[model samples]
Target: MTETMNNVLNDDKKWKIIQGDCLKVLEGFAPGSFDAVITDPPYASGARTQADKQKSTRQKYSSMGDNAPPAFEGDAKDQRSWTRWAAEWLAEARRIAKPGAPVCMFIDWRQLPAASDALQWAGWIWRGTAVWDKGNSRPQRGRFRQQAEYIVWGSNGDMPISRPVPCLPGVFKYGNPGKRIHLTEKPLQLMRDIVRICEPGGLILDPFAGSGTTVLAGVLEGYRAIGIEVTDVYAILAQERIVRELAEAV
Candidate 1:
């Protein structure tokens, strides 16, 4: 749907989902409007094979094939192209993020450099990275099974940002022990941890809000969240998930 036509849901204190292209929706907001940003963007893991697509859509969590790659395979025409795309989104993120506000981008090893470079180019100073160890027991064939992901944190160089919690060192282990609705969906506990550490109150933004996990975390934590998703199917699913989460909260 066009940005103008996308629906914006208004609920109690919770941030609602906005269905549209993130770049377009974000352009309409004032600069430095968000307190913090916790997002998981697409890793550009290359084009999905028809079989890959089918498997992603149909396989149960327990039934995924051995050959299936991790949700994001770090796909791009080249490293340069990947950096360009990341730069575009990150620049916008910097514009909307308050001075010294923390911007957390979730990524894997393959895309970490590119994501970090984009953040630097967008004027955010590199602070540190957080490792989220997803407790998965599967073993890989050639390499060690990746049980973790990274979150790069940065802030605008010139301003004072709020640090709601003390920064913790070492990796954070989060267990995901159930069926998966969205491929590459992060656990809710992970999102909650990030939110708690960042302490975003006015609004939390997630550009690539797959399945609405981040938004749900924000809502549950008593912060308004704004998310953008390209696919209608995911947007619908995210909304449904939010409804269920809200219902459970009551």
Candidate 2:
């Protein structure tokens, strides 16, 4: 590692959760400094149906958009805009991640194709996708249940030589963690499983660390974690949640 890179990652046992725009914060890191990038960004501010063009797909997912919790900033970009926005940060992520470092992103089915295209456009190889089967999806009368979320994971360059001891499974079957601090709060186990893709001692960066599940996962697994959240409330929430989780573990 270069002197700059070493200085940036001087501590390998810390979890730093900063509140700011990820793209801007990402620019501060040295190139090839991170070992992995695992995150869940807004999917083009979500895909709205024709009937409810005003409301975002995420808003629609919440109960009729009335009692929906406040979504984070930058969740209103259209597909094209989001894809382009994704490329900017993704390119920065690729720049900071080591060669062959893993990149994992979460997106719903509607935005899967666009996300894959964006990842490739950002210069990462489209390795393949994994399924996060929620098992119990909302019931639809005629159409199939929306039971699965897609995870687009790839590598920065060639595959890494350091393999995981027990390979993690691709299809995650973890159930939801029930009530959420964030609208799209993922289960901690899901993030933990994803973090395992990187070596245990390696550093993981999450630009869209809503509620800090990904950062918590990295810290819990002995990997240093750096998370940037634009929303101030969520940034505080993430830190509190991490403390609470660790306290409960003890």
Candidate number with greatest TM-score: 2
TM-score of each model, paired residue for residue: 0.80, 0.89
Task: Kindly provide the TM-score of model 1 when superposed on the true structure, using C-alpha atoms.
Answer: 0.80
Which has the greatest lDDT? 2
Model 2 worst lDDT run, 10 consecutive residues? 4-13
Q: Tens digit of lDDT per residue, candidate 1, span 135-187?
A: 78579789888777899887766435445655555477988636556777888
- Superposed by TM-score, candidate 2 places the C-alpha of residue 242 at a distance from the truth, in angstroms, of 1.1
- Provide the global lDDT of candidate 2 against the true structure: 0.82
Candidate 1 minimal-lDDT segment of 10 residues? 68-77
- To one decimal, what is the Cα RMSD in angstroms of model 2 from the true structure? 2.9
Predicted structure 2, TM vs. truth: 0.89
